[model samples]
Target chain A: MADWVDACATDDIEEEDVIRFDHGSRTFIIVRDHEDNYYCTDGLCTHEEVHLSDGLVVEATIECPKHSSIFDCTNGEVETPPACENLHTYPTKVENGRVFVEI
Target chain B: MPRDYDLLGADAKSAVANGLVTEDWYRTHLDRKTMKALMKRADQPAIWDTVVLFGSMIAFAGAAIALMPSWWSVPFWLSYGVLYGSAMDSRWHECGHGTAFKTRWMNRAVYQVACFCMIRDPHCWKFSHARHHSDTVIVGRDPEVAIMRPVVVVRMAANLVGLTDMWDGLKRMIRHTGGRILPDEADYMDPVFFAKTIRTARVWIVIYAATLAAALLLQSWIPVLLIGLPRLYGCWHMVLCGWLQHGGLADNVLDHRLNSRTVYLNPISRFIYWNMNYHVEHHMFPLVPYNKLPDLHEACKFDFPAPNTSFFDAYTEMLPALWRQRKDPDFHIRRQLPDTANPYHDGPARAAA
Candidate 1:
C-alpha cells in the first residue's frame, strides 16, 4: 500500500485548472473540478501522447488539447475517438488544505 | 474525336493498376464528363505550377549551394528541403490523386520521376497518403496521423530535451513506415503494387549508396553534407509540413470542408512548397491543379474550410492548442451519423468484396 504523497496545496490549482505532476515514469494530471473536487488521472491522452494537463478543464471532464478527446476526471474513462483506452486515475485526498495523491 | 473513349478506359485501367483509384472510385468519380476534364489536364503541368516548382527549386538550390558550399552537388536536397519539400507537397500529391495526367502510365511515369528526384516513393506515399485523404486525422487508423503523433510528442518534449533534425526524422519514419506499426499478419487484398513504391525505393537506395561510396572513396565530408544532411533536413521539413497542414488541426468532416493552413510566408515556404498551404481547396476538389489552389481558396473563401487562426499563433502557443484539439477529433469520410455508419470506424468501405 503506497502512502499518499502530498502533491500540491488546494490553492495550487483553481477550479477548471489542470496541472502536470510527474510521478516516476508516469505523469498525472491533477484537475480541479467545478465542485472543487481534485481528481488525478493519467496526464497523457491514451490515443495520442498529448498531455492531459494541457487540456481544457470543463466541469468534471478534461478535453485533450490536441484533438479534443474527452476524459472523465472522476474515473478516467475516455469519452471520444483517437483515444480508446481509459485514463488511469490516482486516488486523491485533501488533508489540511493540501492535496495528496497515492501513486 | 469524341474524347477517345478507348483512351479513357485505358487511363482508368492504368490508374487502377497504379492503385491511384479504387474500383469504386473509378465507377463513381471517373464518368465520361469527369474523365474528359481529367484528360484535358493530364501529364501537362499547369504552366504556373511548373514555373513555380522549377523556379523555386533552382533559386533555392542556387542560394543553398552558395550558402552551404557542401550542399552544391546535391543542392536539390536543400531546395527540396524548402521548396518542393514543403510547398510543392501537392505536386506528388496530385499524382497520388491520379489527376496529374490523362493517361495513367504518364501520371505514374511523372510521379516516379518526381519521387526519385525528391527522394520520396510516390507509390509508397500514395498507399499511406490516399488513406490519409480518405480517413483524415483519425488517430489510430490514419497512418499519416499515427506517423506524426510521436514527432508532435517529441516536439512538445523539446522543452525538456532538444531534438535534432535526424532524431526527428528517425522517430517519424520508424513510427510511420517501419514495420513496428503493422498489426500482426498482413491483410493482403490487392496482390499488385505500384512501381513507384519498390522501384522508387530501389533507385533511391542505389543513388544514395553510390553517392556515399563515391564520397568515401574521395574521403570528403561533402557527401555527408550534400546527400546526407539535406535529406535529414528535407525529410524533417516534409514531415512537418505534412503533419501541421492536417494533423494538428481538428479534423474536418468530409462534407463541411477542412480548414486550410498557411505558414509563415517565407519565399521558401511559398515557391518551393507550391501554395499547398491552400489545403482546404486542394482537398475539396482533389483534381484541381495546384497552381490554381490559391485563386480557388481566395475566390471560394466561404465554401472552403476556414483557415487556422494563424499558424504563427498556433506556433506561439506551441502544442497545447493542438493537443487540446485531440478530444474533438474529426474524420475525413463524412457520414450522416447513424444513417451509414462511419466507414472509418466500421472498417474499409468495401470489405474484401
Candidate 2:
C-alpha cells in the first residue's frame, strides 16, 4: 500500500528549484527538475551534511556545494563522493500541480 | 648482507625501535632483492583498492542515511577517509619523484590519478613539491614553507567560522601568494604549465562538486556531510603532519646532516602515517619508500641533525619555546657564508628581526 503524504502546494515551489522539507523528524530535499517534475530525496548529502537544496542542479544531476559529491536528482543515485551511498528516494508526484511525496 | 646488519642499516628499524614504524608484522625491507620487491609495491596502485575506497564510502553513506541521526552530532569519519584517499596524492607525488616507481610512465600515471583525485595538477605538484624539497624553509622561496602569518591564520580562522573555508580556498586557487623568489634554473616555472595546472585543478573541482550534487539528488546529504567533512579534518591533519614534521626544526642551508630534524615517534603514529614521521629521512633521500624508511632511520639515527625529538615535544615544549619569542626561532639556523660562526644567531634574537 502506498502512503502518499501531502508535502507542499504548487505555489509553494518555484520552477526548476529545490526545497528542503521536513517530513516527520527527518529532512529531505524536494526538487522540481527542469522538466517540471517533482522529486523528493533525503535532504542531507550522504557524503556529508551539506544541504542538497543548496546544491547546484545541472540538468538532472545535483552537485553538492561541499566537496562536489554529485547525485542523480531523479532517482537519488550517487554519482561520486565524498559520497558513495545512493540517496533514498520517496515516490513523488504532482496532483493539481501540488507536489506529494509517498512515504 | 647479514639480517642483523641489514636490520641495523635499515631506516625502518630505527622507525620500529623508536616506535614510529607502524604495522607489527612488517616484512623487513632489507637486501637488494627484497628492496626491489618492496619498491615494486609502489606499482600496485590497484583498481581494487580504488574501488574499495570508492565503494566503502558509498556503503557508509547509505548506512548513515538508513539509521538517520540527529543534526547536533553526526559522524563524519567517511569524509576524513575520502580526504585521506585524496591526499594520498602526495604519496603518488613521492612516486612521481621516481622514488615510488621504477618506471617513469607508471609514476606519471599514479601522479595523474592523484591529480584527478585531489584536483591539483600532477606536473604542477611535482614541480612544487620538488622545489619544496630542494629548498626546505628558505623564506619567500619554498612554496610549502611559506607559512601563512599569524594574521593570515586569524583571517582564515574568521573565514572558517563564518563557513567560508571553501570560498577562501577557492579564492586562493588562482593566486600564487607564496614563492616570491624563484630558484635558479626553474625548469617547471612556466606560464603554460600554470595554465594547464589551473585547468586540471578546475576539472578536479568540478568532479568533486558534481559528486556532491549527485549525493544531494540521491537524498544523501547527511552522508555527504558526514563522509565529506572529514576531508577538511584530514586537511588539518595533513597540515599538522607537514608543519610539525618539518616546522620549527633545524633549518639548514646546504648540509642535510646539520639541517634536518627527525622525530623518534610512537609506532601508532608511524603505522597510520606510513613512517612519514621520519620526515628528515624522507626529505634527505626522497627515494626510500615508506616501507624502507625504518632501515634508513636505523643506519642514520646517530648521524647529524640528531633523531627522536618528538613533534609532540615540540608542540608541548617548543610551542612555548617559540611562542615566548612570538616568531619561529633560529634554533638550528645557520649561514652558508664563511664569515659568521653560524649564519643564524642561535641562542636568542628578536623574532623575525
Candidate 3:
C-alpha cells in the first residue's frame, strides 16, 4: 500500500537542487532536475549514511558530498563508488503547485 | 607501554568501545549555497596543472638523458624526480577523491598514474584513505595516521628518501600479486575490489620487471633512474609535507581542528602540493576540490587555529613535540581555537543540537 504525501511546493526546489523531506522516522529528498521535473529518493547516501541532501546534483546525477560517490537522480542507481548499493527512488508527481511523492 | 596503533589490536577494540569509530567530527557551519559552490568540480585547473606537470617532466627527462655523463644532468634529473615522486602524491590524493576533474574517467586515469608514480596500491590505498578521512588520527581505526604515537624515528628517517615506503610497497605488491586480499586490508576494504587489486598488482609487477630488464639489457642507469628510482630519490617533498599533517597532533579526537594542520607554503611547494597546506579545511570538507581549498580556508579561518607561516615554525613546533612523545606518548601540542569560532566538539551547543 503506497501513500502519496505532499513534499513541498514545486517552486521550493530550484533547478538542479535537492531538499530534505522527513515523514515519521524515514527521510527522503525531493529533487528538481534541470527540466523542472521533480523526483524523490532516499535522503542518505548508502555508502556511509551521510545526508544526500548535502550532495551536489549535476546533470542527471547526484554526487555524495563526503566521498564523491555518484548516483542517478532518476532511478537511484549508483554511478560511482565507494558506494556499491543503489538508492531507493520514490515515485513523484506534481499536483498543482505542490510536489507529491508516493511512499 | 605507550599507546598502541595496531588496527586489529587491543587499541582498536578500545576505540570501538569508546565510541571513536566513525564519529561525526565537528563541521563549521556553511550554508547549502556556499558549500555547493565550493564543492563544485571543474576540469580546467586540474587539466592545466596536469599539463604543466607532465610537460615539465618530459622536458627535464629529455634534457637529463641527452646530457647524461655530465654533472649538468644532475639538476634535470633532480627536478624530474620531484615532479615524479612528490607531485604525484597530491595527484593521487585529489584524484582518488574523484574531485580533481568533473569527468569520472579522467579522475580514474590520473589516479592510476599517480598511484603508480607514488608506488601505492590504488584500491588498497583508496579504502585506507577513505578510512583516514573518516577517522583522521584515531589510534586503532585509521590506517593512514602519519607518525603514529610513540613514533619510530628510524621509520620516519628512512621515509625521507622513500626507502621504507617503497620497500614496504614492493612487498605489498608482491603479496597482492599472489591474488590474496591482505588480512589487515580485508578488515575495511570491500571485497568487490579484490580482483582489481590483484590485477593491478600483476600489471605493476610486469612494468617494474620490464624496467629492470631494460636497465640490465641496455647496460645503463638511464632506464632505472627514469622509472624505478625516481620514487626513491624524489619522495622527500611528499614525506616532508605529509609529516606536518598530523605530526604531534591529538589522536582519538573527532575534531579535525585538533588533529590537522594548516601551514603557509611557498609558490613552488604549493603548486607541487596542490594547496594541501590547507589540510584542516580539506579534512573538514573532504569533497571540496583542491583548487577551492584556499577559499575554504579563508572562509573558515576565523573559527580555526592560526596557520603556521613557515617550515621553521611548523617543524619547530612539531619536532620537539614528537621528541617529547617518544618518552611520553601522551604528550601532544594542542592548538588554541579563536573565541569567535564554534567549538567543534560536543559542547553545550552541540549537545543541545
TM-score of each model, paired residue for residue: 0.49, 0.51, 0.96
**lDDT by residue for model 1 over B199-219, one digit each (tens)?**
445556667688889889988
Model 2: residues with Cα > 4 Å off, grouped in runs? A1-103, B1-66, B70-73, B76-92, B101-106, B116-119, B146-169, B172-188, B215-229, B250-252, B257-259, B266-268, B309-311, B325-353
Candidate with maximal lDDT: 3
Best by TM-score: 3
Candidate 1: regions farther than 4 A off: A1-103, B1-80, B100-106, B117-119, B146-152, B155-189, B194-200, B235-240, B251-268, B313-319, B323-353
- Residues A6-103 of candidate 3 have per-residue lDDT tens digits of 99999998788889999999999888888888889999898888888888888767887777788998999998778889999999999899999999
Q: Rate the local accuracy (lDDT) of all candidates.
A: 0.51, 0.51, 0.88
- Best-to-worst ranking by TM-score: 3, 2, 1
Candidate 3 to native Cα RMSD, angstroms: 2.4
**Residues B140-246, model 3: lDDT tens digits:** 78888779778789889999999888998888899999987777799878899999999999999999999999999999999989997999999899899999998
> Which 10-residue span in candidate 3 chain A carries the lowest summed lDDT?
A59-68
lDDT of 2 by residue, A16-40 (tens): 5567798788898887777777788
- Which ten contiguous residues of candidate 1 chain A have the minimum total lDDT? A62-71
Worst 10 residues of 2 chain B by lDDT: B20-29
Candidate 3, residue B265: lDDT: 93
